[model samples]
Target: MNINGLEKTKTFSFDRSHSAKVLFKRPDKFREIEDLSKHNRTLINTGSNLSYSPLGFYKDSISVKLKKFNRIIDFNLKKKEITVESGITLSQLLNFTLLYDLWIPQLPGYPFITIGGAIASDAHGKSCALHGTIKNSIKEMTIFHIKNGWLSLSEKENKEIYNLTIGGIGLTGTIVNVTLKLEEFKNKNFITYKTKVNSVNECISEITKKSKEKDSFVYSWNMAENLKSLGKGFVFQNKINDDNVENFKFIPEEKKNKFLPFLPIWNKLTLKTANWIFYYLNNSSNHFQEDDFTSVIFPFYGKEAYFKFFGKKGFYESQLLISENTIEDFFDEFKFIYKKFNPTISLFSVKNMRGTQEFLRFEGNKICVTFDFINNKKNILFMSELDKICVKLKIIPSIIKDSRLSKKIVEQCYPEYSRFRDLINNYDKKRIYKSEISQRLEI
Candidate 1:
């Protein structure tokens, strides 16, 4: 259906967890965005249609997609910077940047996430300990609001809005264009060193030590379903080298995933079998890859079926960014919750993350652990218990990962939650721009 030459579509979150019919517009020109800003009180942007959580699509609300806004405005070789429109995908950006042996330091695992969406979500990568979130690469941006019009923001210019807009979840305004600070791609290679860990504590300890190595990524694939060896897993430390490696071709985006099941396919026994096979398969201690750039980016590009297996019931991802001091205590409660609920945890992983702990941003110097649970009453209730732990331990649960996260938990977790809300209210009093995240969190 078409309304006002704009498409009307039933938009579902990437995880199929939330759905809403929206008046969708793919506007290219800054004028169109500004004009929409003037008229629509309820507006938000959608990108790649790929966020796990709903990105502000209420009934009849206008959703602007920046597909046509993709363009490379400027590329300075010496400065290692590129100015691009918000619609440009990270894959596209890297294709262009890698031609000149330059790329964005903060690379998202998904290939098709737009520059705008990355900024809005403040997406973090596996190597956040080294480079932090996408906010670190953003040198400047031009955002449009009804009142502010087209305002250029940066650290030194409009610093407050810049900070807010980074993880603001698109409430601040429509981010039209962004100037990303790029890094020169030297001959850097990483060797994946896998070690068998006894428990979650061992994993965290190894990750902490591994993170100290410069330009390294650390993560653990835990067998959380096993009570006897809970959190027993392999710690993968990708340590870097300056040696040159043969370039591999970029993995193009796969066609629409056809395996979206009608019923959920993940269960404890099934997951346990799969996790066990994967765990011991890498008996070797080290993996040598040919090219860092090609292999490191877009880990999810070819693995769409993993998401589809959740089917209509969808899934819930609770990614907690908890401080080092509180993690030990938090895990005590975590184990109790796991034992009590015995929730169907399909997948579990942990990453060593280090970034700013600021208003509404999930990034922090903490142990970032994520769990994928089948969407059911038991799992849902289990997640609620985790939320309680988050509040008690001052952990920041990722708002972008879960659609059902409560505003009260958000308020309790983030110290500057009220401040972020107040800033948005003051910046755009009518709050013309809002997303699913903002409305849910009452931001």
Candidate 2:
């Protein structure tokens, strides 16, 4: 079968400088996992390459595209559970679930991301303090290994493999299907309030206070215009609007043409101007508004136009999860670095995170902060310095966001790295499932 001409092609957003030819495959063409198990070729499972990390791209290896397996295999309305193929996109899942008045409590900012990709990256959302990551909602999953045809994993069955694969970056095997528990809400509207804050400390305080509410989603954006108003930004708190029955009728489709196809080159001046404008817009008026689920949950959808700001080099995001005790110190150092380097940082966001799991998990109650900067040598060096500080403070950098992280940095950041690697080696002794990130990080 012709797999859409994917053979001998390159994965999307592959590093321009890296000349790696990837051989692609579609599982639907094969009747069973045993078909590929005998081969020694390195096989890397891939979904939509929505991750900023190079988890899906492989150099001169077989890339299995799971997109063709997209389907809703089963649904239990009473249990509010659905089993879906890994390749189903978030948008598709949401649409299907909304028809039954069900919702996935946690979702990333982007809707195009595939379910398998979300679970592998352990993607978090604005309400992570309450719902945790996507892994929390998954009841069970079916993963296919070269040696093991199909293994069933969950909190109770094959729990070790389950833990490893949740944030395992697809090293364990190719996730085939997932059974997820869905949440039910009376309405799909959110009463959103945007409050301007003067500093990162205030932002954290506001987020903490808002997160105390039973069902509130809170996040903050830090302005990067200038040192005079550094860390000044807006905090958004959104609660489910109980009174909006009409909004619950259906999830609104994403707005079209809301963002330009391409943004102009980003520079200090342009970014500062954009930051000022955004701050003014948020602070001017109408701090309170009612928004549909799409607007509240996937706020950044249909905003691919921002990619143009990074120019031809693209961008890199450094996301850190700092414990409550060390958050202030982390921000202090972050601000200092921001002032010293003055890189063209386009965005900064903050959210609350709680709880912990074993393997590649963010331990303790912490706050997640992310910074996006145009990729360049100077900014790369700046990020390296920041990583060193993170290592000292015991801050955990998100492997899903930072593609440039070295193997040493990952080892230092994740204390369980050794054990995680051992699990991978034992599971796939031949190293059949490998990616650029897996090899680069020595996973």
lDDT of 2 by residue, 399-427 (tens): 77888888898899888888999988887
Task: State every prediction's TM-score relative to the real structure.
Answer: 0.95, 0.93
In model 2, where is the ten-residue run with the lowest total lDDT? Answer: 10-19
**Model 1, total clashes:** 2
Give one digit per residue, the lDDT tens place, for model 1 in 16-65: 77888778888876677767854445888877777888874766468889
Maximum-TM-score candidate: 1
User: What's each prediction's clash count?
Assistant: 2, 0
Candidate lDDT scores, in order, read 0.81, 0.80
Determine the C-alpha RMSD for candidate 1 after optimal superposition of all C-alphas: 2.0
